[model samples]
Target: MNAEAAIDLLKQVVLFALYVTSPFIVLMLLIGLLTSLAQSVTSIQEQTLTFGPKILGLALLLIVLAPWLLRALTEFASSCITRMAIVAG
Candidate 1:
């Protein structure tokens, strides 16, 4: 592929990765921050307290967002495949 085409592909790949991962990562970050704040307020220093909530939140988030995430990835993959076919043709 030409330089411009390669750059575009890289940009798409980065965007797709961010789109797929941003939700879970952001959720975890927010949960961690909130949990820290709660712990600070309540003076509970249990290490496991944060883990359970974060995991459960992320699981729930994944369940809720799975369909949209899957569809986006599928579409991106399909488009990439189609582009590859056109390039090869």
Candidate 2:
């Protein structure tokens, strides 16, 4: 209801989003790093070489994490909805 409480809720929302997306982001980052390293070592200049593996990895990651992501988001949504009344007044 108050500005402080609203700010706290915003903080929680931001943190929850970051937490939910962290795994996927980290996965992509590592993939890209390895791709860069291999490209450097092999002296390969093909730009598209990394795309396939990254795409496949991202797809697999999404498939693996989808359920967990959904559950976390659902829980966050449920909690926010349940707190709506308190926040409203």
Candidate 3:
């Protein structure tokens, strides 16, 4: 592929990555913030206080979103493969 096409593909890859990971990232951020707030209120400054909730939240979200995530991934992969075939031939 030409430089332009390659760059476009790279952009798409980055955007897709961000889209895919956004939910988890957002959840983690909110969980961290809430944990920090709780710790501050309780005057319990434990460094590891945030891990359990974040992990559990992430795991639950992953379970709930697994099917949709898989579908999105499958669609993206198939689209990329199709584009490759078109570019190649």
**Candidate maximizing lDDT:** 3
Model 3 residue 80 CA deviation (Å) reads 0.6
Q: How big is the positional error of residue 20 in model 3, measured in Å on the Cα after superposition? A: 0.4
- Local distance difference test, candidate 3: 0.89
lDDT of predicted model 1: 0.88
* Candidate No. with top TM-score: 3
Which pairs in model 2 have colliding backbones? none
lDDT (Cα atoms) of all candidates against the true structure: 0.88, 0.88, 0.89
> Model 3, range 28-85, lDDT digits (tens) per residue?
9999999999999999999988999999999999999999999999999998887665
lDDT of 2 by residue, 1-89 (tens): 67776777889999998998888889889999999999999999799988998899999999998998899889999998876666787
Off by over 4 Å in 3: 87-89
With a 3 Å backbone cut-off (N, CA, C), the pairs that clash in candidate 3 are none
Q: Candidates ranked by TM-score, best first? A: 3, 2, 1
lDDT of the structure predicted as candidate 2: 0.88
